[model samples]
Target chain A: MTGGSELPIASNADVVLVRQQVRSAALEVGLSLVDQTKVVTAASELARNALVYGGGGMARVEIVENGPRKGLKLVFSDEGPGIADVEQALTDGWTTGGGLGLGLSGSRRLVDEFDLVSAPSKGTTVTVTKWAR
Target chain B: MERVPILKLGDILIISIQIDLEDQSVLALQEDLAEAVVAHSARGVIIDITAVEIVDSFIGRMLATIAAMSRMLDAQTVVVGMRPAVAITLVELGLSLGGVRTALNLEKGVALLDHVRGATP
Candidate 1:
């Protein structure tokens, strides 16, 4: 198994850039375009969530092996206002701003596995994984 | 963002969306789409999203809402030119754009609308 890498995203504009990096990293790990697109989309949503809701954060992209399968994992963490109601925030159409509130919820649907950790005032972290199949 | 109306073919309206479909810019497109569908009594509408690179959940939800609204106005809406990456993202975000049609490209989208209109009449 090969080692993984981490990319930091600090600004809103960097979200898109980080997505590209994630795509490249996924490809470097031998993911096809279809799989690459999936990872990129996941990265973009998580990165955007970090920027919009978390007031900016960083994304960590890494490759890992899971018992006969290899996959990519993206972890997005932010030090902004943590979610007050994590469940409500995950619900569709629930939003604090004019947005459609699809960021976190939608991102969960695209990846093979998803996990989130957040609090009211501490911060938020989202981790997603896509397996090579 | 510039809004360019491609043409009015029959009762269907085809418009080219020349802007990044982001959280901030989707609102204008939504309003304009509503107005155009109502004013023209369009039976179908095609939106070109080739210029858009990424689509977050906010924009996806807005597009879904717009499609629903268009249906209420008696018009069917189709989103065209979704990059593979965008489609993957939308699906991952758990957004099911029910009732909204999608095509690989604008030309194909127009052709689909034509077929739909023809089948109806």
Candidate 2:
């Protein structure tokens, strides 16, 4: 996986920008429309979490090649008051906000590979990959 | 603050989200819609999202909330013109958007609003 550019997540507007970058990455790797939408949506959700929950962070994208197959990877990191319970946060119906609590688990479902790490006061980083079929 | 316009079509209020919406803009739309519904005495509402490519959980929740708000005011709501890709994304995002009504286009959406209002108590 070759790392690409990084995008900062500040406000809601940057969320749109993140989606744009994610969409372009998916297209650059020649993902189908449905696949493109999935990655873009997942990026949007995770980006929002970085801003709303993590108190703002940045996202990096990359193109990964594996001997005749290609994939897209997104890494989101934030240094804020970290999550106390990772498992509960990833639950489908768990949210500290007014949302339906589908952000973490939903994004995890969209990507082929998912990784999340957090500490009480340190921060959190989420990485996901979606491979082209 | 950038605001999406709400058009009054007889007894219905039509809101078209034609651009990428920020959090502020989405909130503004919600407030404006509530005011327009009351001002025009609208009986139905149609939100056109054909131009919307990505509806994250935030926007999806906004839509569902707006539908519920409009419903409490006795106005039927119908969402129209969701692209297939967006639909898949919404589903994958895990939001059912169950309380809202949807149609293929504005024409059918308006008709649905009328039909729903017509048969309601």
What's the TM-score of each model vs. the native? 0.69, 0.96
Best by TM-score: 2
CAPRI-style grade of the A/B interface in model 2: medium
Cα lDDT of model 1 by residue, B1-121, tens digit: 3344445777887766665334444666678778878787888888777876666665677668877998899887889998776776666566767767899887888788788878887
DockQ of candidate 2, scored on C-alphas against the true complex (2 decimals): 0.79
Which ranges in model 1 have alpha carbons more than 4 Å from their true place? Answer: A1-12, A64-70, A85-102, B1-21, B31-43, B49-56, B69-75, B81-92, B103-108, B111-121
lDDT (tens digit, per residue) of candidate 2 on B18-114 = 8878888999899989988998889999999999878888889899989999989889899999999989878877887998889999999988877
lDDT of 2 at B15: 91
lDDT of 2 at B50: 91
The candidate that achieves the highest DockQ relative to the unseen native structure: 2
Model 1, position A108: C-alpha lDDT score: 73
RMSD of 2: 1.3
Q: What is the interface RMSD of each candidate, in Å?
A: 3.2, 1.1
Compose the digit string of candidate 1's lDDT tens values, residues A14-126: 76568767877787767777677667766777887788778888888788888977888888999989988889988977888766676677667777899989998899999
RMSD of 1: 4.5
